[model samples]
Every structure is written in structure tokens, then in C-alpha cells.
Target chain A: MFKDAWLVASKDLRIERRSRVLTNQLLPFTLVILIIFAFTFDTHPNLLVTLSPGLFWVASLFAMTIALQRSFSLEAENQARDGLLLYGLESAGIFLGKVVAIVIQSAIVELFIGFGIVILYAAPLHEVVFLALSAFTATIGISCVGVVFGAMVTGRSRDSLLPLLIFPVVAPVLLSATKAWEDYVRGKVSLGDPWLGLLVVFAIAFGAVGVLTFGSILEE
Target chain B: MKSDRAVQGLGLVAVLAIVATYILGLWITPPAAVMGNLVRLLYIHPPVAWVAYLAYGVTSVASILYLWKRTRDPRWDLIAASSAEIGVVFTALTLLTGSIWGRPTWGVWWTWDARLTTTALLFLLYVGYLALRRATPDVTQRSKRSAVAALIAFIDVPIVHQSVVWWKTLHQSATVFNASLSPKVHGEMAWTLLLGFIAFSLAYVWMLIRRYQIAVLISKRQEILLQGALDERMSTV
Candidate 1:
């Protein structure tokens, strides 16, 4: 299972590297969202700084949608999904591999968005470690949920459906991640710990669910 | 035809129960000392909310049955889909009635209160489930994907509720719209609430049967149409 996972992950990452889709498209899209938020709330810098945590996660949420779309779109061509099923690849491995690839891609966009939030909103860069850890765990939860829905919506032309499906479901992730970041930024580390813990719990629980259910989804 | 008669009988009983509930709730029950006449909405609101949760619970269980290899059946898929449709309607009513109930009670139509937020999220999640069903063109694929989605979304409900409750507590805003069952149910009001639950549950049964029948009929029609098309092509060839 681990070997199959690595093979799948490497294939996806190699495709992503060669295509440069993340750098050329999704990264800039997230930055643009950051810029738009900066302008939308340009009334005062202080307000922007206070709201940066939410804005950062909202941008990450949007980027997660695109990353999920790209992940499944890679399988849309030439019966690739059929090949995976027929070739005897472990469904759990494929599920984890896809999740890992999406997490990596989302993390890159999240890091850029984090930097953009700092530069654009003038948020103080004090809780670097807390922010990074919170963001990493939250991204895992987001990716796990996103990949499951992404696979579910494959071969369907309803582009709007993915976000509509994912946004409400992942509300807890957004709520916790945003609150954790807010607490960290406001220097209330103790308050943020529970939310961070919630993020980790969500990530693991959803990842396990994905591993258990992906085989059914893939075969069906 | 037999099942149709049963559904009709159930529908009639549901209608009668609902009407009885309305009369009891509006006139027979004494006005609440606390909420006054506004307590009338309670009969409708709580029952609708009950139906919503009940319907979703049915969907989730049916989905599990459909997904399990040993017990997989097309009827479970139909049950899941039909129950989900009913669930969405009840959820919408729950939100609407909750909002209406809140206007006078909470002094606002809506707040980020835990139950209300969780219910809204539940509504959206199932809306997505229905949309997923519509988006997938294949029957088997649709059933499988939707069943899985149903289970995932169902599992998320408690987590969403818990998180929202925690978030509310952390913020320490006094929630005006308390969702706990009133500990002080007395006399006719209790009877009326009971009637409301019974009426709604019967209504859910009637609706699920009708919706499931329609779904079966539609699929049968599609099969016939596909057969006709294939026959025509074969004749031409």
C-alpha cells in the first residue's frame, strides 16, 4: 500500500511539476484574491490586520477548490481512472496519494497567501511557528475532504457544484483554522490550542474516512 | 395500487393529525406565561425540525445499507434519495420557522447560534447531495457516490454542531434562542407537541413512499426509452 501510494504521489507531483499549473495559475489566483480583499476592506489598515486570519483561510478555501479540480481533472482524460481500477492499484493508496499531492499543492498556495496576508494587510509576523503548524494541519483536513468530493464530481460538468458541496462541509475547518490563527495573531496562544487540536482531529478523522470509502467510490 | 392505497390512508391520517394539532396548539392550549401566544409556533417548529433530522437519519442509514456489499440493493438507493428530498424540505421549514420564531423572541431574524447554524449547514450539505445526484448521469455511479456522500455529510453533522456550540461558548454571547426541549411542558401543550410529532412522522412516511414510487417509475421509463432507441437502431442497421 505504501509503495503504491508513493508511486501515485510521485506521478501526480511529476505531472504538476511539469505542467507548472500551481505556479502559473492557482498561486496567482490566490494572490489576486488577497489583493481583492485588501482593496475591499481598505477603509483602515488596523481592520485589515484584524481580519487577515479569516481572509487568509477564505483564500485558501478557494484555492483548495481549484487544487481539487486539477487533481481530478488529471484523471478525466483517456480513461485514466479505469486504468487505475483495472491495474489493481490499492484504492486506499490512491486515495492517500491524491490527498498528499493536493495537500502539498494547497500548502504551497497557502504559504504564498500567508505571505500575501502579511504584506498586504500589514499583519505582524510574530506567531510564525503557530501559524505554520495550524495552516499545515488545516490544509490536510481541507485536502482530505476536497479530494473525496473531487472524485465524486468527476465526469460531471457542474463546475459550481464542487464549491457548493465542499464549502458548507468544511465550515468547521474554516471556523477552527481562522479562530486559531486569530488567537495566535492576537497573542492568545492558550485559546488557540483547542482550535488547533480540533484541526488535527478533523484531519485524521476525515483522512481515515477517505481511506475506508475510496475503494467503494472508485469501483462504483 | 395496494401501496398507493396505503400511502393515501397514511396521508389522510397525517392531514387529520396536523389539523388537530393546529386547533389544539392555537386555541385549546393556554398561552405561555413566558413566551405568551408566540408559543403557538412551537408545535410546528419542533415537529418540522424533528422530521428533518428523522429524514436525514433515514437517508444515512439507507445509504449505509446500499453501500454495504452484503445488503446492497437498488431500493436502498431510492430510499436514500427520496428521504434526502424530504429532509431538505423539512430542514428548510425548520430554518424558516426558527427564523420566524426568533424575530419576536430573539429580537433578530437570525444569529450565529449553534443549532440554527448547524441546521443551515445541514440544509446546504444535503442540497449538495441532491445536486451530486443530478450531476452524475449513470445510475449505479450516482447511487454509490451519493451514498458515500450521504454518510460523510451525516458524520459531519455532529462535528459541525459541536464546533459551533464551542465557538458560541468561547465568544460568550448569550444565546436567546434556546434549542433544548422545554422542561416545563404542561397539559395540552404537551399533547399538542406529541400530535405534531406524530403528524409529521406520518407525513414523512407518506411523502417518502410517493417520492420513491416516482423515482422507480422514472427509471422504468428511462429503461423503456433506452430499449426503444436500441430497437430502432437495430432495425435501421
Candidate 2:
């Protein structure tokens, strides 16, 4: 399973590396979302700073949707989704693989958005370790569940449908990650643990859901 | 759809029981010491909220049955879908009635209290579930898709339950009528609350069976249509 997961992950990354979609399109889109928030706040640095944790997750989640859509669209074309199953690749592996690819893509966008918030929103990142850990767990939850729903709407209007399907599913990530970061920044570092624990549970729960259900989803 | 006698009986009972609940709630039961007339909304609000949760619970259970290989009957999918459709309605009513209850009690139509926030999120999550159902055209595909989605959306159920416990809440905590087995609310109010629970649960069961019947009929029609299309293409060939 691990070997299959690595193969699938590498295949997606290789395609992404050559196509430059993640770097050229999705990354810029996330940065744009951050800037849009800055403008929406009327360039009030203080308000932006206060609201930055929520704005960051909201923006990253938007970008996560685009990245997921791109990830699945890569499979949708050329009947590649069927091809993945035809290769006798483990369905769980394919699920984990897609999850890894999405996680990396989303995290990069998250990283740039982290930079964008600092430079544009004037929000200080006081605890780097906590922010990154929260992002890591939160993005895992988003990607695993995102992958499930992403593959789901591919037969229809995926671009629009994916967000509606996933935003509500991944809402816990949005809520917990934002709160964890908010507390961390307020210097209540220990208070972040409970939110972090919630994120992990969300991640593990959906992660299991993805692996168990992906086979049947692919068969369909 | 032949109207099942049992279902008809259930519908009559549900209506009569709900009427009893309403009459008792609105007129028979005296107003609270503090809340006065405002307390009447409690009868409908809690029961409606209970049905909403119960509806989702039914959906999740039916989904599990559908997903389980040995027991993967088509009826399970139908039940899951039917329950969720009404579950969304019940959830909407939950929010509406809660909003009405809030205006007099909390002085706001809505607040970001933990319970309210989680409930709102659950409402949207199931709405998305229904949208997902509409998006997929294949029956088997739709079944699998929605099954997975249903289970995922159900993750919030526990959180919503615990939200008040975990966080500071504008929504009232379970004081008299809480999870504890002890009773603080008594007399007509208690009996009416009990009737409301039974009435709503019965109503949910009745609506579920009716909706499932409708869905079965639709799927049957769909199969016939597919057959007709296939027959036409073959005749042309």
C-alpha cells in the first residue's frame, strides 16, 4: 500500500512539475485571495491582523478546492480515472497518493499565503512551529475529505460542485485551525492543543473514510 | 403508490398527537415563571430540532446498511436519501423555529453561539449532500457517492451535541430538561414535552416511509425509461 501510494504521489507530482499548473495558476490564485481580503478590510492593518487567522484558512481552503479540482481533472481527462484502476493500483494507495499530492500543493499555497498575510495583512507569526503543525493536520483533513468529494462531482460540474460539497465537510478544519492559530498568536500556546487534537481527529476520521470508500467510488 | 393502512394510521396519530401537543403547549400549559408566553415556542422548537438530528441519524444508519456488502439493498439507499431530504427540511425548521425562539429570549434573530454555529454548519452540510445527489445521474454512483458523503457529514453530530458543553454558549445549557435522567420540568409542561417528542418521532417515521415509497416508484419509472431508450436504439439498429 505504501509503495503504491508513493508511486501514485510521484506520478501526480511529475505531471504537476511539467504542467506548472500548481505554481503558475493555483499559487497565484491563493495570493490573489489574500490580497483581496486585505482590500476588503479597507487596508486596515489592525483589523487584518486581528482577522488574519480566519482569513488565512478561508483563503487556503479556496485554493485547496482549486487544487483538488485540478488534481481530479488530471484523472478525468483521457479516461485516466479508469486507467488508474486498470493498472491494478491499490485503491487505497490511489486515495493516499491523491491525498499526498493535494496536501503538498495546498501546503505550498498555504505557505505563500502565510507570507502574504505577514507582508500584506501585517499579522505577526509569533509561533512558527504551532502554525505549521496546525496547517499540516488541518490540510490533511481538508485533502482526504476533499479528495473524496472531488472525485465525486467529477462527472458533473466539478468546479462549482466541489466547493459546495467540500466546504461544509472541511468546516471543522477551518474552524479549528483558525482558533488554534488565534490562540497561539495571543500567546496562549497551550490552549492550542485541544484545537490541534480536534484537527487530528478530523484528519484521521476522514482519512479512514477516504481509504475505505475510495475503491467503491473509483469502481463507480 | 398504494397508501399503506399502517402509514395512514401513523399519519392520523401523528397529526392528532401534534395537535394535542400544540393545544397543551399553547393554552393548557401555564407560562413559565420567567419566560411567560415566550415559552410556548419551546414545544415546537425542541421537537423539530430532535427530528432534525433523528433524521440525520436515520440517514447515517441507512447509509451504513447500503454500504455494507451483504446487506446492500437498494431500499437502504432510498431510505438514506429520503431521510436526508426531509432531514434538511427539519434542519431548516430547526433553524427557523430556533430563530423565532431566540428573538424573544436572546434579543437577536441569530448569534454565533457554539450550538447555533454548529447547527448552521450541519444544515449547509446536508444541503450540499442533496446537491450532490442531484449532480450524479447514475443510481449506483449516486448511492456510493452519497453514502460516503452522508457518513462524513455525520461527523458533526457529536460536535454539535458537545458544543454547548465545550464552549461558552448563549444557547441555554441543559438545566431542567438535560441529558441527566433527573426531572426538573414537571406537570403539564413535562407531559407536553413528552408528547412533542413522540409526535415528532412518529411524524418523522411517517414522512420517511412515504418518501421512501415515492423514491421506489421513481426508480422503477427510471428503469422503464432506460429500457424504452434501449429498445428504441435497438429497433433503429
Candidate 3:
């Protein structure tokens, strides 16, 4: 099972290496989201304190949702999911592989957009290290759930509906993570701690459930 | 199963429950000192919210059961659909009474308080679930999709429940369930609330049995129609 899981994960990584479509999609999309935020919201330093975290997560989430929703597209579309099933690989292996790849994929975008938000919005990064830690924890939470939600809703004619279904339930993470980000930007170092705790909790809960449920959902 | 009998029984019970709730709520319960006649809205409002949440829970549990066995049991699907429909009705009642209660007490018809906002969003989410099921044509696909959707949507319930603690809002926390109720409220108002809860739970069960039967009838009709169509197509071919 461990070997199969690693192989599945590496398969996705190899596809990305060869095509680079997902990474390509994330870079431009996240950059544009930031640009739109900069142009749209008042970029005053105080406003930055107010909006920085929200802008970062919202952007990262949108870009990452697109990436996550597409996580299974390659396997699902060409009947490759059946191939994977036929390999006698553990279903949980498949879920773990996809989720790990999604986390890695979204992490890249999150790091870029997260730092860029600080630079563009002129947010004080006195706790830049803490902000990154908080954001990373929150990213894992969102990506963990997003992986399952994305696959669960896959194969629908209307693909965009995945986020509509996911965003509301996952909004707490985004909302809390952004709150922590705002506090970190504002130099209220202590305030970010609780939100950080919530983020980690959210990530672990979803990841654990997703792992357990993935096999059942994948069963034919 | 003699479903028609269940429906008839459900209708009878629903009428009786409504009458009982109204009588207990209006005449039996005492008026509030602070809110006056407007406090009567509590009898209807809380029951509706309670039933709505209960219905959503039913749907969530049913969805899990359906997915667990892949039984494609019509009864399970019926329970899910019926509970969701009944839930929507109660949610609407909750919103309407809440708004009415708000007008008299808060001097506004609506407030962006956490509870109110969360309750309103809950209505939208379930309504969307119903619509999603309606839009899909394939029964299997509908079953699978709505099952997942129900599970995902139920996650919002806890957040809605905790919105009071999570955010700063004007909405008061659980009045009946709160720790610090005055003796006056505890003696009289608590009894009224207990009666209200009982009445609503009965109404929910009655409605579920009725709606469950209706759903079964519809699915049965659908199966017959599909069979007839297939037979015609085969004969022509």
C-alpha cells in the first residue's frame, strides 16, 4: 500500500514535470488575482492590515480550487480511473496520492501569492515567519478537503459547481486563516495563535476523514 | 407497506400537532415582560428551526446509509428528499417568524447578527441542494450527487450553531438552553419551550412519514413510466 501510494503520487508529479500545465495555470491566475485585488481594493496601509489575509487566501483558494478540481480530470476523463482501479492498488492510496499532489501544487501558488500580497499591499511583515506558518497550516486544511470535494463532484457536466459546493463549508478555514493573516500583518502576534490552532485542527480533521472515507467513495 | 395509511395518519397527526402547539403557545404560555405579545413568536420560531436542523441531520445520516451499502434503496432516498423538503418549510418558517420577532423586539426587521445570518444561509444551502437534485435527470447520478452534497452541507450546521461565539453579533445566545436564566424564565418559559419542542418533534415525524410516502409514490411512478417507454421502444425496434 505504501509503495502503491508513492507510485501514485510520483505519477502525478511526473505528469506535472512533463506538461507543467497546472503550475503554469496557477502562476498567471494567482498573479492576476493579486493584480485585480490591488486595483480594486484601496491599497492604503491600514486597508492592507484589514484585507491582506483575506485577499491572499481568496486568491490562493480560487487558483487552488481550479487546480484541485482538475486534479482528477486527467484520470477521470480518459477512463484512467478504471485503470487505476484495475491495478489492485488500494483506493486510499489513490486518494492520498491525489491529495498530496494537490497540497504540493497549491502550496506553490499559496507561497507566491501570500508573499506577493505583503509586498503589493505594503503589509508589515514583522511576523513574516509566523504568517507563513499560519498560512501553510491553513493551506493544508483547505487543500485536504478540496481534494476529496473536487473528486466527489468530478465528472459533472458543470464542473465549476465544485467550488460553489465546497467554498461555503470550507469558508471557515478561509475566514479564520485570513483573520490570522490580518492580525499578523497588524503586529498583533498573539491574536494569530488561536486562528493558527483552528487551522491546524481543521486540516487534520479533514485529512483524517478524507483518508478514511476515500476508499468507500472509490469503491465501485 | 401500506403507505397511504401512513400518509393519512401523518396528516391527522400534523393537524393535531399544529393545534396543540398553537394552544400551548398562545394561551398556555405566559407573555414576556420585555417583549409583550411579540414573545409569542418564540413558540413557532424555535420549533421551526429545531425541526429544520433535525431534518438536515436526517438527510445527512440517510445519505451516509445509502452510500454505505450502495443499496439504491428507494426508501432511503425518499427519507432524504422528504426530510429536506420538510426542512425547507421549517427553515422558511424560522426566517419569517424571526424577522417578525425582530421587528417588534429589535426595532428592525432584520439584523446582520451571526445567528440570523447563519440561519438565513442554511436555508439557501438546502434550497440549493433541492434544486441540484431537481436539475439532474439521471436517478443514480442524482442520488450520488445529492448524497455527497448533503454530507458537505451539514458541515455548515455546526458553524451556524456556533456563530454566536465565533463572531461578535447582536443575536442572544441560546435563551432556553443558556446557563444563566432567571428563575422567572426558568419556571414558566422553560415549560413552554419544552412543550414547543415536543410538539415540533411530533410534527417533524408526521411530516417525514407523509413525505417519505409521497417520494416513494413518485419514484414508483417514474419506474413504471421508464419501463413503459422502454417497452414501446423495443416493440417498435
Which candidate wins on TM-score? Answer: 2
- Please report, as a value between 0 and 1, the fraction of native contacts recovered by candidate 1: 0.88
Worst 10 residues of 3 chain A by lDDT: A151-160
- Per-residue lDDT of candidate 1, residues A16-91 (tens digit): 9999999999998997898898788989758888898899999999988988888888898897987987888999
- Candidate 2 runs further than 4 Å off: A43-45, A190-192, B1-3, B175-177
lDDT of 2 by residue, B35-93 (tens): 99998887888888889889999999999999888899989999999999999999999
What tens-digit string does per-residue lDDT give for candidate 2 at A1-220? 8888999999998999999998899888887787788788856549999998999999898888888888998999999999988999999999999999889888888999999989987788998988899899999999998898887886757787889888877777789899999988898786338999999998998899889878888887
Error of 2 at A171 (Å): 1.4
Score residue B89 of candidate 1 by CA lDDT.
Answer: 97
Among all candidates shown, the one with the greatest DockQ: 1
Q: Comparing 2 and 3 by TM-score, which wins?
A: 2
Q: What is residue A42's positional error in candidate 3, in angstroms?
A: 1.6
Q: RMSD per prediction, one decimal?
A: 3.0, 2.1, 3.8
Q: Which scores greater on DockQ, model 1 or model 2? A: 1
lDDT of 3 by residue, B213-234 (tens): 6788898999999999999999
Per-residue error at A29 for model 2, in Å? 1.7
Q: Count the backbone clashes (under 3 Å) in each candidate.
A: 0, 0, 0
Highest lDDT: which candidate? 2
